[model samples]
Target: MSAFEFVFTFYSLMLGLAAANVGTGFADMWRDRRAIQVGVCAPLLAAIVLVATMNLWLRFWRSWEGVEVGPWALITLVAYALPLVFLSRAMFPGAGSTTSLEDHFFQHRRVMLAALAATPGFSLIWYAAQGTLMPDWPNAWLAIRFFAPLALMALTGRTANRLGLALILVWMLVGLFR
Candidate 1:
């Protein structure tokens, strides 16, 4: 196998597991809908995680396909993938519990947001290590556009978190067209 393929095989599996985790979480909520209060926040978070995992998979192919894979690349890739898995797992309560999805979301919000916010920085570092070319923007507005609202949401109330998530979804949608 080519070097990228060799490394990507493992990465693909991780992403698949992340996606599956999100799907299963959603399914569990559906199956228990009669007993469970399926709330907005957790489902929204699941959507973000699922879409982000798919984006990461596409990014791996687009950015890393021709790049040389080494020990550090493997290490960084693992670091990147684990938080995604954690975020996926956090999207729902454990196998059996009576907590509502909203309660589960608030209970895990800090860790969930932390994991969500971390990936962009890790992506930057991974690309830097690989000498991948990044876009040069005017005044670093792009970075601020993401990190600022997330930081606000992480430190503020529920309203801010909802707003931040809306912003993130908008950004993701905008990114798709770019």
Candidate 2:
């Protein structure tokens, strides 16, 4: 296989696993039938969708004929994928838990948000390193979409969390239209 294919195969696999992990978390939450904090679940679910969407977006790069794929490019891709997996796993505390998903989410909120906050920086670096962030799209969207959550988290209020959730939903909608 070509270097690009070889590297992307692993990248895609990581993203797939990330999506599955998030799906499992959601399934657990649904099956458990407990009160869920919309503030937490909304953005967490949005992050899941965003990660999966990113995997789909990567498909477009597979056809970029002349871009050179090197060892560092592979490394960068892996770096971008790792936090996604961590964030997915963080979303749900564990399997077969009696504790409410909402409680687990509150318990792990800081770690989960830290992982969520790191993903965009890693993604931007990977894309820039790989020359994949198209000039046609203003890079500001990356900052607006990714950092907004971190800013809200830092603000540390119910209003901020609600605003974060709204931002995430809006971001998802914008992604859908793009």
Candidate 3:
């Protein structure tokens, strides 16, 4: 593969790793097995997803060359990241403990489903906004990415769920506007 392709693949994998980090919240959730599991897994999951995102960008980084400021990838990426921010907030339980886990979970379920549901729309926007040469790829990949959150929404509850929802909302919003 070309250098760009290599970098992209590596980053994509890293993104997957970071996405994997979300799983840690699950491990943390369990009362008995929570500590070890979450402690080990959460960071790992985040790492995976983070890596994946960066790699994905690397793969497409060239697309930025001579490109305008506002592309679908940029919008989608920002939108996607927003949910993670909120989810991190919901999960961490900092100043805003009032946002219950249950609420988060319910919201997560809705958002994830919405994101999956919204795929076509997001794809359309991505195509129109970005003037994409490879429109089909990103849209398809997004559907693939939806799996983790979908399962998490179904199985998880409490804080994890809420975080999941928040993340999904970000996903949805990004798709909608992009």
Candidate 4:
């Protein structure tokens, strides 16, 4: 197999696992739909979907040309995928009965936040390591597109979460059109 295919297989596997985990979490939530809090569950669910979608897009955008694939690059890429896995796990309750999805979310809030926070940070490192940080994008668009969600995540209010979700949805819609 080619180097790109070889290296990408591992990355793709992790991404698939992440998506499956998120899907399982959604199923669990649906199973316990009575316990879902729209205020909390909606944003968290949206973020999970966003992460999975973005990871898929990232795989498409990533290329193996003109760059050396070494231990460090592989390590960085794996590290980048780690946060998604963690976030997926965080979103779901353990096996067996649980109080509620909201309760699970509150109990694992820090883990969820840490995992979410790590995604952009690790993504920055992964892109930088691959020498694709700025490619052909305008700096302002990159900053707003990448950093805005992180900034929104810093807020701990319901309004902030709703706004953040709206921003992400709008941004994603624009991307689809483009």
Candidate 5:
């Protein structure tokens, strides 16, 4: 098999497990729905993680197409997927526990956001290692597109509800335009 194929197989497995974790978490929450108090933030964050996982999976094909893969590439790929796994695991409450979604979200938001923030950095590293074609995009644009929402969420704390919604809206708008 080709290097890209072999390497991507490994990456895809990790991504698939991450996706499954999120899906299973949702199922578990539904199973325990009557025992838990549902809230806005945790569900929103779950949606975000689910979508981001899918995006990374889909984007991988286009982004890594025809790329050379080596040991360091494999290492970086594994590193990149680790955060997604962690974030997925964090999306739902633990077993046999009753808690409000908001409480769970607040408890884990920092780690979740940190995991979200790491994806772009890993993508950049992979691109740089492969010397792929992203030089035309400015650093400022990258930072604004990727980091702004995360930073706002990190800094604003509990007061970021409306702001988070606004940011999601803005991100959707940006995606539409792009």
Candidate 6:
């Protein structure tokens, strides 16, 4: 496989790992009783995001490896990418119990579902920034990935999120150096 294939494969795994972390973060928050809503919602959302991201990523990676995007691959690719676009913003931090109730969606459900759906849009940003070229794409994409740091801080709490962001940046730097 080419370096692009290898690097993107690693990046895809990284995204999966990040998604898992998101689930764990929410689970932890829920366990701590800090955000019951996040705890209840985050794990499920994370799984969807992870599955979808992985599916889309595999298709792209296969194509990068010079494989054709066949029917199955195309199906998975679409299944993953489009949902991720809006799902990114789901379960945002600002919504407390007073802000949204489960039944609220029937009347203005889309409006009520805002917080739980923000993350997917950001996921789209991350994916798009990854680009379609080689060598230059992923590396260049890291620069744009910077936008995620603040959101991470907010979602995970400033101190812990900062550390996590720093760690991810460090990992990205190592990949660049490699």
Candidate that would win on TM-score: 1
Top-lDDT structure, candidate number:
1
Kindly report which residue stretches of model 3 are placed more than 4 angstroms away from their true locations once superposed.
Answer: 1-41, 70-77, 95-125, 128-139, 156-178
Tens digit of per-residue lDDT, candidate 2, span 41-158: 5345546456444744454364457435787766766666777788777766566666655566556666666666565677676668768776554355565556765676566555
lDDT of 5 by residue, 1-178 (tens): 8777888799889988888887888788777878897677766666666666666666566656655778877787777788878888886778987877778877766676777667766666555776863656443344554575577555646657636845654563454334
**How well does each candidate superpose onto the true structure, as a TM-score?**
0.84, 0.75, 0.40, 0.72, 0.79, 0.35
Candidate rank order under lDDT: 1, 5, 2, 4, 3, 6
Query: Which one wins by TM-score: 1 or 6?
Result: 1
Report lDDT (CA) for all predictions: 0.74, 0.62, 0.44, 0.61, 0.68, 0.43
RMSD values for the candidates in order, in angstroms, are: 2.9, 3.6, 9.6, 3.5, 3.3, 14.7
Residue-level lDDT of model 4, residues 1-178, one tens digit each, is: 7777777777778877777777777676666666544246544554545554564446445556733568976787667677777777766667665456656555555556556556556666656776878855433334455565567656766566556656655664555444
Residue 173 displacement (Å), model 5: 8.8
| Clashing pairs in model 1, backbone N/Cα/C closer than 3 A | none
By summed lDDT, the worst window of 10 consecutive residues in model 3 runs over 32-41
lDDT of 6 by residue, 47-162 (tens): 44454455446445655755443564444434434444444434333334433211222223233233223333444554566663334754344433334433443453434433
Q: Mind giving the per-residue lDDT tens digits that candidate 1 earns over 80-141? A: 78888988987788878999998887777877877876676676655567686367641132
* Over 4 Å off, model 2: 34-56, 59-63, 66-69, 126-136
Sort the candidates on TM-score, descending order: 1, 5, 2, 4, 3, 6
* Residue 24 lDDT in candidate 4: 73
lDDT of 4 at 154: 65
Candidate 5 vs 6: which has more TM-score: 5
Off-target runs (Cα >4 Å) in candidate 5 are 125-142, 153-159, 162-166, 169-178
Q: Score residue 177 of candidate 5 by CA lDDT.
A: 34
